[model samples]
Target: MSGIVDLTLTYTNDVAGFSKEASKVLDVDGWNASTLTFYSHCGTHMDAPIHFNVSNQTIDEIPVSNFVGKAWVIDARHVGSKGLIKPEHIHQDIKDKFVAGDGLIFWTGWSKYVNTPKYRDELPRISEALALWCIDKKVKMIGVEPPSVADVNNLDEVTKIHQILLKGVVIIEGLTNIDALQTNCVELIALPLKIESGDGAPARVIAIEKYL
Candidate 1:
């Protein structure tokens, strides 16, 4: 492999209710240990079927092999903020490369607005038709740089899209540094914390570029 590229977003205590504090300081004549407290879905995370389907599988129940696979990063930077990523946005060349069980990542250059309000308000979302198209392609997972794959302001639509994808595919959100990847295809390794029966958990995702 050429090298591994980190695709996870840095977690901080910036968001209200999410905090990382020093539980023990070395200067206080004790071992230094920090306590981190945050939502399971915060930062770079993976969503399980239970996130939308309460009766479905949780993150812990998912097979370990599912988190690692061949991934394709589709460039959709031409999509405008608050735009829809339609089926046509994915060209035939990219579609012809799809194989069952492959992981798909959309790069829309939205990670540039990570901490800004625009990140939440103006993210490009996948259209329902495009989402179903992925499902029909039998993809193993779908990832995006945005916080959500659906319209966050539209609860009904959000739920619909989530249900559609979560039926058989994993959903990864809040990814960053996608533009740093040197290739469109790579080995993706995104493993989430094993929270038993938990809905979803933050993940440490990376892309490995194999030279040979």
Candidate 2:
């Protein structure tokens, strides 16, 4: 790892409004106070169990330690667009070094498309084998630069992937500027906005490279 790498994006009221129908800003009776509203799965956000199931826990229910820890950066840029970041993409040596609760950040160079639909349309995804690998590895968290680890158009695969990972490890998606970091171990601190009983929330994710 080298210097600090910012994995979150700048949230703006203009980018994409909260939902398709919800108003981003609330207008008072006559006041001009600035107001913005968004869902938990907004820019650079984390996904809680509740985001998938109504009976699941919310954002505030998450443990703080789950969001901060040592992480491994897996460089899979060689596996280009629409590539499946499988367990094979990860080096055997890297897998051997993973601690039980280490964070795993995959750098597929797919984050270059942030605001464009192509970003979501053509994101590199984690195969079932890789998702199961994280679970078996006891991974504390998994962060990615793309919007998600599953194909956006395929809900079945997305649901399968999320359920497997979200059962234990925290899922941080929509990260940007991760290419700035070196390909090595780094200390990650990604704490989301403490929204009470909220399914998810945007987070400020940063990494500090260790000096060996």
Candidate 3:
């Protein structure tokens, strides 16, 4: 039998200050509907090359296959708040499981701070060397439990890491529930909304696992 795990954060007004307005109500319009006001990159989202690359390629232009692939979850919980995630953190065991075109997710146990003031301030960042390692491995996509791959306060570093990773892979950020994954290896399916010429878009990400 196979089971699915949802790896997305619930889009809420309290989280990231995304707003929602009731457009139609059951008592007045005989239906219930609301208009969402949030940034395209808010919540769990995917970053297209255009997000950091100069070219015109956007989220809608990326192939669907890039968002779905075999994923390996590397345990990075040891990384402390505001610490750097270095290449050595991966170790040989995790590196052995890496295959070209595989999607990689780092479980840093950082999702616990979501919706808090310290969430952005205390994000653990990926080192440039680690980013290069991923590039060398030809990873298809990279996901993290943090809001970004780099320190949010450091604009220069953020741009550098995004540019490096986006050169050959998609990046998924603001992911949650990664710690709930029962296995290290699973099928990752993270599809973003198709928005024309969009730099990035929020996504509904999940993992599918088969049990013996």
Best by lDDT: 3
C-alpha lDDT of candidate 2 relative to the true structure:
0.82
Model 1 whole-model lDDT (C-alpha atoms): 0.86
Winner by TM-score between candidate 2 and candidate 1: 1
Once fitted onto the true fold, the runs of candidate 2 whose alpha carbons sit more than 4 angstroms away are 18-33
Worst 10 residues of 1 by lDDT: 10-19
Candidate 3 has an lDDT of 0.87
Provide the clash count, candidate 3. 0
TM-score of candidate 1 versus the correct structure, residues matched by position: 0.95
Tens digits of lDDT, candidate 3, 103-189:
788899888898886778889988899899989999898999888999878889999999999888889998899877788888889
- Ranked by TM-score, top first: 3, 1, 2
RMSD of each: 1.5, 3.8, 1.3
Poorest lDDT segment (10 consecutive residues) of candidate 2: 17-26
Using TM-score as the measure, the top candidate is 3
Question: Candidates' lDDT values, in order?
Answer: 0.86, 0.82, 0.87
Report clashes for each candidate as comma-separated counts.
0, 0, 0
Model 3 Cα shift for residue 169 (angstroms): 1.0
